[model samples]
Target: MKKLTTALSLVAVMAISTQAATLEERVKALEEQNTVLTEEVLASQSAGFTLVDSEKTFNGMGPAASKVYFSDNPLSIGGYGEMFYANPDNGDDFADVYRFITYFGYKFNDWVVLNAEIEFEHGANADKGGEVVVEFLYLDFLLSNEFSLRAGHVLVPMGLINLRHEPTLFNTVQRPEIERQLIPSTWHENGVLAYGRFDDLGIEYTAGIVNALNVNNSKTTTPKTGWIRSGRLGSSKNASFEPAFVGRVDYTGVNGLIMGASAYYGEGSNLKNDDANDVDGLTTAMFDIHARYENGPLAAYGLYTQTTLDGAEKLSSNAAEKASGYYGNISYDLGGLLGVEYKMPVFAQYENYNPVEKTVDGQNEDAFETETVTIGFNFFPTKQTVIKVDYEMNDVNSQETNTLSVGLGFIF
Candidate 1:
């Protein structure tokens, strides 16, 4: 009977031990769940996102990642830069590695924006003499989708590329000649611009005073090669005016296209030391029209610009002479022609221009005309990076020249 009692005692002890083990496991699991919940709470608090107990859904993060964030108002940041190598193949052997352009910009509230573009030709050093320019420093006020005002350094909106020529944004190695010569690509001066979008008519008008022409013969004169030096300065005849009025108009959102016209007219900005010499004064006007079509993977664009000058004493004196120039450019894109997708974007583009038309002082020889044609393909591994290969033929009214360019262009 004593042995039976001891056996019952052992059985009771086993039951109590099993129950204790099960209770300990349940407590451990509850503790682990609490730890996980604490960790999740901490993470959510630090990350600035709400912690939800339900399923997760994908959110729109594309714009945020791209630096194009949307708040009560939309804002975007974008810019591009390029480095290039050129072989003229003319036996003259001219090669340059340069920083094309760098731009930083901000857009605020739909009606106000800021943009600054800096250019480094060889490198960012003073001896190389790179230029620091304010491409556009202005405030834009939008009364409505149809009416707005822009004041500051306004671009001379006369060509197709001038308004949208980010290095990675364009397919060609360089801008077309017509845009470079006739319309003066990258042309901007101090002024206020008025623009609006009305239904199918996208209209733009600008009138502002700007530094007048520099007719200083000593400053603008160059050698007999007809390469008219750099076009950064104005004529000497109207040095005193220092400013002139400019304007433009554009039509957009029409059936499959966009078109525009522009005009610039102003008195000379320079002053003459000798009034009797008769500084005939200077006046310039540019007219242009453009059209483009883009849908899906295909795109095409074309434009023509003509520039004219009048009022000069003669080709030699601080007097302006009658000179005119014109150019045209067109480009078309063919979607990945070989099924290469991002590896290949075939394109064909052509440009021709006669930038300088005045005769050499005393020599009575006219400036040579410049024309360029480019055919190439682009490889875009991503939206921000591109590899370009192009063959260009640059012809002058006096000679023939060509260049082959292949390079990588990107933005970060």
Candidate 2:
């Protein structure tokens, strides 16, 4: 009986030992799996594309253009696109893929970065008034919070829309006409720029020397017709490279408010090579004051700009010596009032501009005078996408023309 009892006790001990071993093996396997899953989650987060932060901007650039500054990976890719349909009172109605732009960026290190923008306009079909072009390519050397350097093809930081031209940033179906005619929002040039910010003072500054505009190389009409708008020599192969000085300053001391001024001074003549025009010492000066404010459901923005040509009279009998314009826009979001998840903003805008506000020969000064009134609304299904509708009334030299437009825009 004693031997049998001892044998039973030994058997019970062996069973317990076996159970302990099994539990140890299972725990070890589970630990290994947990480690592997943690690694995969980390790798996936750091790889592929980073989602855009719509409210974030760096160095006064649009949100997508500023993606590189906040990327975790070395390579960052982002872009924006827009399409619209227009029906005019006296013109054929048409739909156009207005612009598609892509931004590519590489982080060489913490302090050095490279960024480029490639653009396709009008569907990129060369035969149908479409073309692909490089809008900007630049390298930034981030030295400190107070100062940094940017070199290469850079956007001219002269006006509000010139630096922030993304479709979602504005409220209208089209860009402000004043910005397009007087400020030339998409202006870019090859140059070096120095920029800095003072956080305590809420002041930001940019000063640079860029390729000057050659009045002799007007692509649209003669220099006399649209001198100010036509003088933008953006990344053109035949563009002359004369040095121009540009400076800008903004005050952001108040929350959700930005007010600033900018100026450009340059010689507009292409005397470096033998051009057909007999103009010399043609100096161009431009200046603008701009402001924008947003608080909860309300938003407003506007600008006043002027340009002067010193030697425009020598270029042509009808050349414009002065150009000036002003515009204002205000919008209120109904989403907040209605307690909806999506955003809906209704807006109104007014503009008065004359590309030929003053002529050298003092004739037909009012020929290009225009007054525009636009009423629009935008529906944002998502933070990165918007659908827009607007009606525009344009009075050109007292002739009224009206148009209706619908559009969609997106960024990523």
Candidate 3:
């Protein structure tokens, strides 16, 4: 009986020891879990605080990328560049190109802003004379949502792309001759302008005054007329800073569509001419229409411009004859092929230009006419970078020559 009792006591002690050991293990596990939970809570709180502060600070800056100063108020800087390659069917070779621009903008307040852009062409190489040009320098004053005033060097807003066309913004490798000759793309001079929109009526308008055109750049197709015509029309002369009239009217409510009509009338002067008074004043005018529809990865666009020169008979004997030119282009984009994430934009464009109007003294003068068509594809691996390939066809009216070109271009 004594042996049995001793055995029972030993079993009881073992059972109690096992129970205590299990309790200790559970407490240790619970403590470890609590430590992990505490750490997670601390981390989450820290992140939340950081996000709130960041939001507040961002909001306080008031949509500014740069600071304000006394002379220059709120300023912002942005620009882009492109490189290209070309192989012309006419045997002319163009390879590895570069064009760059930098723009600086200052906003005085909600109503006024100043913008300037400096451009560099052909890689800024000394071999190309390193053409450094000011593309635009202007001040804009917003009087109301429906009306604004602008002045200084201003773009002649005749063609669709003349004012807004940038390498990255355009789908093709080059602009059409029609635009170059008819409306003179990238043309700007000293001028003042007014523009605005009426949201209730869905109408927008732009108008401006600028310097006039010169005889050398006039685009008259006929040759028999004198070269000394009064193509110098628009605003005033260089010495006087003549002002030309330019403006446009637009409609913008058709679901992602922008359609507009534009016009320009101006006069110009010749400072270097010995017989300045004899040179006829240019009576110049242009008319154009453009439209764009874009949504997501798809886009469509078209533009046409026609220009005429009058008052040539009023000029002296040494001037040019009556001259005129017109241009048109159309394009579309097809987004992503092969079910890939990348955006594949394919487009085609046409351009024509007649630079010189009539020759001098019976000599076969330059009746410069150029026509070009381009089909290209742009691959956007990312939002900020584009790789482009294009095939271009050129038909020179004077030379009766044709060329084929292929090139690569990019922007960032």
Report the C-alpha lDDT of model 2 over 271-329, residue by residue, as the tens digit. Answer: 45676663668888999999999999999999999988887767777677888889999
What are the lDDT scores of the predictions, listed in order?
Answer: 0.54, 0.88, 0.58
Q: What's the lDDT for candidate 1?
A: 0.54
TM-score, candidate number 2: 0.87
TM-scores of the candidates are 0.68, 0.87, 0.69
Q: Write the per-residue lDDT of candidate 1 for residues 1-412, one digit (tens) a residue.
A: 9999999999999999999999999999999999878856754564522222111110111111223222222433334566666777786634454555544445676656555555565565667666455554556666666666766555545556666655555677776656654555566555666665566554544445555444434423332221222332422223344565565666655655556666666553244465654345555555666666655566677776654445433434432232334433334444445565554556777665544455334333244556567788887786667778888887777577888887777664
In candidate 2 the C-alpha lDDT for residue 334 amounts to 97
Best by TM-score: 2
Q: Per-prediction RMSD in angstroms?
A: 15.0, 10.3, 14.9
